[model samples]
Target: MWNGDGTVEIDGFRVYYSEVECVRRIFERHPETAVNVRPKNQLVKNAYMNNLLDLIDIACLAPQELTEEELRDAENTLLDLVGVDFELDWLKKKLDELCVKKTKMETRGDCMRELDRMIVEQRQVLLALEVELKNEENEAVSDSARLGFEDVV
Candidate 1:
């Protein structure tokens, strides 16, 4: 329940405002598990387990709602999980939405500005990934050439 201010008292324990907000998000995402509440200790354990499971899901299973920065940071791991072709396909799909769809749809003022910013960021990330791939390809070629000369000598 609610106890004045922004705090919530669940099972005789007072949780802070920020913690309640995080729990609210979790509950919103998992409404079925949110409904059944037993004791305080069990609720806490369940919440912890749910949070851990969510993290594992984000890292390994489904990567929904991942930001550009996160994808860039974990590019190798993601590529390993889903393959480079799949990653590129997904990125192209998102770029198409951000580039073509948004321009076609009419957005105004602040929303338009935010959308524009997002498009620019995504474009930059795509460019960087391309450059990185090219660099790696060049390095591999050079390394193979060096090994060939070593075998000759």
Candidate 2:
């Protein structure tokens, strides 16, 4: 005969009986049997619960499951775990802004270097011109002195 819950066994007649009844009777007769049985069931339940919790955690962290609120909370928790402030778009935007500012700074630095080079070149040209002017003035003074000496002689 088959007992409820689909367990089958031979009925009374010194023959097989319902497996379910047999098990039930075994547990009843040996109450200590429950000590073993309960832990097994509890372990299985705990395993299932742990698996579900992991799935929920993954879904929440990755924005793959759960509601929007749950995702937000998970995101916040993840950011907190990594010691970062939670801002969905902040990282990307900050990187872009920094890149733009870096380019501008590089350009400005290049321009400043070019200006410095030009200033150095101008200083060299001015020094050359001053030397040439002094040479011309010396020649003029020497010519004037020679003329005066020739007149005196």
Candidate 3:
């Protein structure tokens, strides 16, 4: 860091050092990036953090101040932002709609499962009907033969 600006030497060239560590801590709770690259990741991280601040409107809170659920919710939101590839505004909208997205996916999956069950039931019913028809035909033929044999006697 030089003159309060983050700078680093890369390939014999000096450049602005990106703070991907901050992003990892907020989203993954780690201190370093997995690959130690992606200079733009820091920008996304800063914007996401700022947006969270604006959304929550709380600057500082003691660890004991927030419940477990609240802490998890905040952490999940940041994690969600890290996965978003769009602009900051889009990220905000996505965060607000995250719960709905999951619900929709789950509901669709349930519908698909129900349809599959119905198909299996229909197939079983059709098979049973075919067997019943075959049994009735065999009984009719046997009744006719018995009648003929009785007439001959």
Candidate 4:
């Protein structure tokens, strides 16, 4: 028997069921879903995405003998579990917006690092100029002290 949750049990020979494998199985079952099939590293690293995939997968388990009421109930269960309105176009738009925001944040971080580097270099140049000015003042004072005057009172 298959639990429809990516786990099957029949003759005691079963495969390990994990969230990553569950997502892969969902893709295998519902080849028509238009969402991007993320890589294994992404599915394993993001808990929210994995659970969302699980919710999206619930529809693939439609029983072979579902009546109208059972089908409606199953649909409601999927909606309640995921909390998404399930509009394919709207979801795709949102995904694109998120990718744009991530890129902007990375660019801002790089700009901030460059600004910090410029500030440090300017401070070093100012320090060298101040040391040179101090040495010129000391030389002028020593030259004045060595000037000799006539031997008159």
Quality of model 3 by C-alpha lDDT: 0.51
Q: Is 3 or 4 the stronger prediction by lDDT?
A: 3
Give the local distance difference test score of model 1: 0.51
Cα displacement (Å) at residue 2, model 3: 10
Write the residue-wise lDDT of candidate 3 on 1-153 in tens digits.
332456543222233455334333333533232233233555554555455544343224443344546545765665655555322343344444544454566688899999999999999999999999999999988877655666778
Ranked by lDDT from best down, the candidates are 3, 1, 4, 2
Looking at model 4, which ten-residue stretch has the lowest summed lDDT? Answer: 7-16
Model 3 CA deviation exceeding 4 Å by range: 1-87, 143-151
RMSD of each: 22.0, 22.5, 12.6, 15.9
Number of backbone-clashing residue pairs for each candidate, in the order shown: 0, 1, 0, 0
Arranged by TM-score, best first? 3, 4, 2, 1
Instruction: Name the TM-score of candidate 3.
Output: 0.40
Angstrom error of the Cα, residue 134, model 1: value is 0.9
Model 1 pairs in collision? none
Per-residue error for 144 in candidate 3, Å, reads 5.1
Q: Output the worst ten-in-a-row residue range by lDDT, candidate 3.
A: 29-38
lDDT of 1 by residue, 1-153 (tens): 886866676434355565766556544654443233333474554443344334334444233355555545444343332331121334334444543333444344568889899999999999999999999999998887745566788
